[model samples]
Target: MTTTPFSVGTFADGDAPPFPGIVVDGRVHDTRAVLPAAASTAALLTDWDAALTALQSFADAPAGAGIPVGDVRVLAPVQPPGQLFAAGANYREHVIQITVAHRIGAAGASEAELRQQAERELDERAAHGEPFVWTGVSTSISGPYDDVILPDVGEDFDWELELGVVIGKVTRNVSAEEALDSVAGYTICNDISTRSLIGRPDVPMMGADWLRAKNQPTFFPTGPYLVPARFVPDPLNLDITLRLNGETMQKGSTGDMIFTPAALISYLSCHVILHPGDMIITGSPAGNGSHYGRFLQPGDVMDCEITGLGTQRNHCRTTEH
Candidate 1:
C-alpha cells in the first residue's frame, strides 16, 4: 500500500487556470486549498512522501468532499522541470526497427544471413553499450490537453510516448539500487519530433543536432497526472499506447526498453547531479509514427496513455504563418 494516492492538476473548469491538485477517490483536492503549505506540485515533489503525510487529512476525507473530477482542467502535474533528459535509442526493438527501415546490410553477403548477423550485433550492443541520452529545453513543454501547433517548415511531425521519471531528491553517483529511491513520481510524456529536421547536411561532422530537431515549442506534452512512485510498483512493465483519431498508432511496453529507468538514472547521475523536479524520460517504445508512415497534421488528435499514468489528448493545429 502507498501513502500518497494519484496526483492531478488544478483548474475549476477547462477554461480556468491550473493549480496543484491531488486526486482522492474520484475527487480533486487542491493541494494548495487543502493544505496552505503546498503552493505547487514542484514544491511537493521535493519531499513527496512528507508532503503526502502532511496532507493526510485531505486524503482521508469522503469521496465527494472535494471538487468533482470532471470539473477540473488537468494540467501538467509539475512546473517545467529544472533539468530534462531524453533517452535516445534505448529500446531494443525500436533500434532494430530503425536498422531494418534503413536497409543497412550487416555481417554477411546474403540477406537472410545478414539479418541473423544484425540480430547478433544488436544483442551484443544491448549487453555492452551504454544508453544514448539527449538534453531537452524546458520551454518545449506544454500542458497535457494543450494544442500542438505543427511547425510549418517541418512536414513529418511524430510522437514518442514515454514514461517520465520525476526526481525527488538531489542525487549524484548513485548505484542502480539507490537510483529508484530518488524517483518522486511517474508521468506520461509525448516526446514530439520533427523527423525531417534531424539531418544537418552542412554540419555532418557535428553529428545530430537535437536542439534544432527537437526543441520546438510544445514539443513535449506531458502529464494528465503524476502517479507517485509508491503507487506504481513496476515502472518497467507498463503498457504504452497512443491513439490517433480513434485509430491506434503506437502500442508497446516499457519492458522492451534496453536500458531500465534505474540504469539510466544511475548513468546520468554519474555525469551530472540530478535535482528535485528534474525529469528524465525513459526511451519511447517501438511504435512511433515514423514506423507506420503516419505523421501528425492539422486536426489530428493524439490520445496517449501508460498503464497507470493518466491519459493526455492533444489537438494538432497548423502554425500561423
Candidate 2:
C-alpha cells in the first residue's frame, strides 16, 4: 500500500470533457496514460488496490505536464456512484437537533428538558440501537462547487454536511471489524434536505418521506477530491465545519457520531450489497439549519469542510424548474 498522501478527482478544462486525475501538491495530472482503466474516478475505484499503486507511482513521478488545479473545473469525484446510502440520526447532537425541531418530546417540556431526554435516549441507543440507514438516489450527486437550486416545492431548504465513505470492493455481510477494509477513501458531502417535505402526514403510516425531501437535484453537494483512507488516520476524529455566508453555522467533530462508519457499513451489509464505487455518508453534526431555525435562502453561500477531505462552497439559488 502506498503511504504517500494524495487524492483523486474529476476535472475538465473549459468545456472539455471531464477526466480523472491524480491530485498532489495542488496540481492535477491526467491518469489516462498512467491507468488505462480510469475512464472515470468511479472506474478507478472498481479496482482501487491496483489503481492506488499506479496512482502512487504516477504521483511520485508525474509522466507529463500537469495543470494548475485552479485552471480547470473540479467536478464531483464520483459523478454517479453505483449506490448511495445515507445514515440518519447517526450523530448524538444531530438526533437531539431533529427531535427538538419536530417537538418529539413531552408536550410543554422546555428545550433543556427535551435535550436531556434526547441525550438519555441516545445513551440507550448506543448500547442497543442499530443504525438507521436509508437509500438515496445517485442522480442527486452534484459537483462540490455547483449551485444548489432551491426547488420551489419546499420552503425549508437545509444543509447537513457529512463525511462520505467510498466503497472499494464488492462486499456483503461484512463485520464491523472488517468494514473499514472495504473503504477506499473519504470525501465530503452536504446532504441538503427540504424540511417542509419530510413528513408524510397525509399517509402517516409511512413515517418520513426521505425521497422527496432529500433527493432533489444538486442537493447532495459532494467532493472536491477523495483522499485515500490511508491518509485519514482516524475517520472518527476529523473536524466537521460549515459556514453560512461567512458566519460559522455548524461546528463539531466526527467523534460525536453515534454510529461509526464501520458500524454503519456493517449494519448495511446485512441486507444491501455494497459494490465498488458505492458510498455511505455518515450523518451530519449538530448545527444543521433545523437547529438554527434558519434555512437556505437565495444567494446564500455555504462553505463546508472536513479535515483532509477538501472543502465545498455551494451557492443557493431559487429555481422554478
Candidate 3:
C-alpha cells in the first residue's frame, strides 16, 4: 500500500488558503480557525489497516476540508503518549562528546578522571542496559514551532534534536524484524533540557538521567507532519541535521545510531508492553549545544530537520515570572 501524508491544521474560510499541519491522536489544537479541540489520535492508531485507510483519504482530499495547515498551528504530533521513551548514548560519538565535555569543562576532572568516571558509569549501565527508559508525564511535551522557555531555575539549558517514532500497534516481545511493523509514523522532536538539573554534582544519586534533562515544557517541539512509516524506506539511513538560527549546528545521519530502531523496539518490548501512541525518541547526534560549547538563550531560534520527516523551527523565549 502507498504511504499517506498525515497533516493537521486549521481550515481557513473559502477565500484563504488552508493551513497544513499534523497532529498525533490527542493534543491541544492551537489553530485559531479551529475551536478549542482536544482529541487523541490513539483510536486511529490501534488498527494499522484502518489508520492507513483514513490517512490515505485525508491526504488525497484537496487542501480544504476545514483542515488547512496555514490556518492551524501545528503542535507536537503525539498527544498524551502512553510512554515517552528515549535512548541514552545511542550515538557513540555523542556519548564520547558528552563524557569529554563533562570531564574537561564542568566536571573539572582530568582525562584519567573522566575515563574512570565513564568506565564506572558504563559498568553500572551495563548491568541495567535493558531496553529504553520511560520518562515522566506528558507535561513535558511541546509543539515543534513553540518557543523553548529557558527555566530561570537552571543555568545549563541544552538542545537535542531527535527523530521521534509514533507507535501504531500493541505488541510485546516483538522481534527486531517485527518491530518496524509497529511504527505508525515519524516526526521531529527537540529534547530541550537543563543540564544543571540533571548534572548536579551535589546529587550524586541523580547523576544525569538525560530523560529528565530532555523533558521540559516546549522541550519536545515536534511535527509539521507525520510521514507514514511506509514512506521511510530505511529509517536508519536518513540524514538528521540541526541549525541554530540559520547556521548549521548538527550534520549527521541516523546510520550513526549505536542501536537501530528495530533493535530498540525489540529491546524495549522485552521490558514493557508497547502500545499505540507510544513515542520513542532516537538519541540525538553530536553537535548538541552541551557538547558544542554553547547553550540556548532567550531569542535563539532552533531549526531541527530530519530527512523525509521535515523541519521544525523553535524559538527560545523565557516565561514571565
TM for every model, in the order presented, reads: 0.92, 0.96, 0.79
lDDT tens per residue, model 1, 205-293: 98887898788988999887777787788988899999999998878999988889999999999999998888999988777889888
Residue 196's lDDT within candidate 3 is: 74
Worst 10 residues of 3 by lDDT: 27-36
Better of 2 and 3 by TM-score: 2
Model 1 stretches astray by more than 4 angstroms: 1-4, 10-17, 62-64, 107-115
Task: Return the number of clashes found in candidate 1.
Answer: 0
- lDDT tens digits by residue: candidate 3, 1-321: 553444442222356443323333333223322322323445455565575665455555423344334445555665544578877677756766778766644356787677666666655654566534556556777767778888767777888788888888896999988899888888787777787778657777866766556666777776766677877888889888889988999888888776778888888888888898788888888898777678998888988889977788888888872
Sliding window of 10 residues with minimal summed lDDT for model 1: 106-115
TM-score of 3: 0.79
Full candidate order by TM-score, most accurate first:
2, 1, 3
lDDT-wise, the better of 2 and 3 is: 2
Number of the predicted model whose TM-score against the real structure is largest? 2
| Clashes per candidate, residues 3 or more apart or on different chains | 0, 0, 18
